[model samples]
Target: MRLRHLLSASTVMLGVIVNTTAFAAAPDVVRIGVAQQGTGDPPVFGGSPAATAQLQHRVEDSLKTDGTKVEWIFFKGAGPAVNEALANKQIDFAYQGDLPSVLGRANGLKTHLLLASNVRAGVYLAVPPDSDIKGVKDLRGKRVGIFRGTNLQLVADNVLKEHGLSERDLRVINLDSAASQAALASKGVDAVFLDYNLFKLQRQGLAKIVYASRDGGLQFTRQAHLLVLEDFERAHPEIVQKVVTSVVQASQWSSDEANRDALFALWSKSGVPAQSWQAEYANQQLKDRSSPLIDPFLIARYQAVADDALRLNLIRQPVSVNGWFEPKYLDEALRTLKLQSYWPRFDASGKPIAC
Candidate 1:
């Protein structure tokens, strides 16, 4: 479990037969899938300057001299759509949120958790101004907009349970984030569970904040993680290692205190307000949540997520969280970059566990 041990494993070494560093079986094109809303000018989600492009450049520089390229696959249906691509073997790597990632694995999609990009991201619950809805308790018997097949469905349901309510108690309407936001603003739905977009609408006096997981603590936050297809891992560990290194490097940069303002600005390029980003990350240290380390906290949290999915029938079977992680690449990357001690580590409760 130590960085030194993981990095020194023989499997972590680069493998290439010719002057060309391309794998004997490396695919001509590497496809990285984005499981978020879109990849437009101001994307809803993607790894543009984050890690995907950096991975492409690094691979071409050190391994693929024959113009091996990285292609990004964008999705509108979010995690469910990305799971389709992963199941069909159309993608080599993917970035996804909790529910679909775990469900895919439970249903036999072969992939490994590579890294965690962000955590403690609060889900926004917005009700129309002058509406009688006050909180989760008020959501019962009300029409609430939820994106069913995505993680939001389960996340919102869990939040409701925390208030002694359940999805069964409400009239749930399925809609994507964009449509959901519009519907809420138009009073088409009694309430909506979404992300920072809700807060932005709240600022405009179009919606009222009913409940925010921001006050619910780290255990309530939804997480996004990077994953690699298992077949690709067995065939091209070298490529996987390099790609993970790029993400680790990005995480390192994102966790620096000096980069806090710049990171928020870059994130705001996705069309979210700069002030919203500031509020969401308020009082949070950069490395506390952004650290790429696959620690005990992260592993245990994902385990509980899988368990919850089973209990709620979101997933048919249980997934083994521990075996699903391929941390050698991340460990190796940290050591080579001399960043083993650069980021803070925390336990399940978000308490500082290491540095």
Candidate 2:
């Protein structure tokens, strides 16, 4: 009887040990996908903490001691291709734009919005120098190139509607960023709706900037974010916390006014000239753009993106912003880092507010 009783206790101990081992198992690698690739051989990106984190190796540095490797996969196809990777479970996390992420959610991709990577990023409209087109309204009945399925498409639509025009009023061509630049330079397209890269073309006298979203105010700007797979988050909350914390640290550095020049220099690796970044960010505060908070303003912008996405038939169904954001990790990171008040909070109207 004594021997039998001892054997039973040992069996229970062995079961507990197996369960604990399974529970604590961590993946050997963490795969991160970036929607946009940079110009280098092993590309780098800019304009977000995810980019900063990658350039600085913050995330990898945090996990290196644990024997976990970080793999960053950049997509030349941008946000739409990132959605496909997410769908196939080929990536554990992604840095993507608002529209593509919403479309992914509507199509049943289970992920959590970690935090805003970049916000209030303006778009531009450029036409060939000496062209007859002078403004947004002039694009009516003219061939205009846009990178469809990107955050730019929705912003372009909104800007057109503001000018009493829609995409239907123009001959719209779906071109990627590089193709759009080439087409605009060759006058293959009458005008191109693009980002700061257009400034480079203007410098070369290849294109004329007719309109910029900065003049239209913050509502016309676009947003991007960092998101993690739902399954990955559930399985490794500790690793998720570390990743979020590391990104928050990078954000803190990127937001400082003292680091402005250094920040621009670091981001210029993406093939965009530093002067272009300086011009684009010229009246903007770094903290306002580089904020890692998932505040009310961020939520409102995403919800508006979802609404517009549906109204524009970009998505088959409505996507909910609620429960889509997982803020506890961000909250904990801010708290532990003693940076709860480091970044300013904004209201839904994009005005600064106390929280």
Candidate 3:
């Protein structure tokens, strides 16, 4: 009887050890996908280890304490590739522009918005530096380079409509941002509708900004959003909270004058010239407000985007913006991390004010 009791105790101890080990190893590393642009033009994600390191550090700091790890995957192609990876379950989260996210939602992919970035940042209509084109109206019969199913196209369409022009008014060539920059430099297209950052190359005298979407307070509403696979969020709430916390912290860090300089330095190493960085940095600071918080206005804007996307046939059907976003995750993360009180508050005019 004594021997049997000893044996039973040993078995119970072994079972406890096994259960602890399994519990500790249950959660897998989170995979994040980022778009990688080529070495030329605006330099989205190519060079600079310091910048990448900073980003990695921010992510680790957010998720590491809970035994979660993050693995980043870079895709060399455009938004379509990123969306494909998300669809294939290869990545848990990504930063995508407005149009691609809309397209992704339309294709039966489950996605949710984490936060909004740079909604008011403008798009530029550019031409070769020496070209005589003076305004949007001048490109009526010219070939225009644009990335279909991206924010650039949305801005182009809205701007053209404002000018009493339509898609039929110009020759539209579907091209990615880098390719569009090359096409513009080589004069393959008379003009290109591109993001504000891409204008960095044009500022180098490689091209010229013929028109900016911000000219008329037009509210072009070009935006980038943090997206998470719905299923991933369902399975890993803690990991998702960590990601939201980190992104909020990064945005706050980027807001500081000192850290802004560091970020610019990182961007500069990525092929963005100093002057261009200064200009784009200022513009981004204004648009992003560097708080990484969402507001009612942002939600309304997202709803508007979904409506416009459906009307343009960029999306098959309208997605209810309310169903796709849950600010609770962000709010909880901020509160838990002591970030809520420190974040900048923006007024109705989109200007930052003391909270």
The prediction achieving the highest lDDT against the true structure is 2
Model 2, position 93: C-alpha lDDT score: 92
Cα-based RMSD of the predictions, in order?
7.9, 1.8, 4.9
Please provide, for model 2 over 58-171, each residue's C-alpha lDDT reduced to its tens digit, 9 standing for 90 to 100. Answer: 999999877899989988899999999999999999999998899899999999999888888989999999898889988899999999999999999999999999999999
Estimate TM-scores for all models. 0.87, 0.95, 0.83
What TM-score number comes out for model 3? Answer: 0.83
**TM-score attained by model 1:** 0.87
**Cα lDDT tens digits for candidate 1, 1-355:** 6877876664455332342455455667877787766535434442223433333244445445544677767777889999999999989998877788988988899899988877656687889999998788888899999887676677787788898988889999988888998999999999999877776888899999878876876667777788999889887887788778877777777778897777767666566766777767778777766778887778877887888898898877777786898888988988999988887677877677854
Using TM-score, rank the candidates from best to worst.
Answer: 2, 1, 3
Error of 3 at 327 (Å): 1.3
Steric clash count of candidate 1: 0
True-vs-predicted CA distance for residue 195, candidate 3, Å: 2.0
Clashes of each: 0, 0, 0
Model 3, global lDDT:
0.70
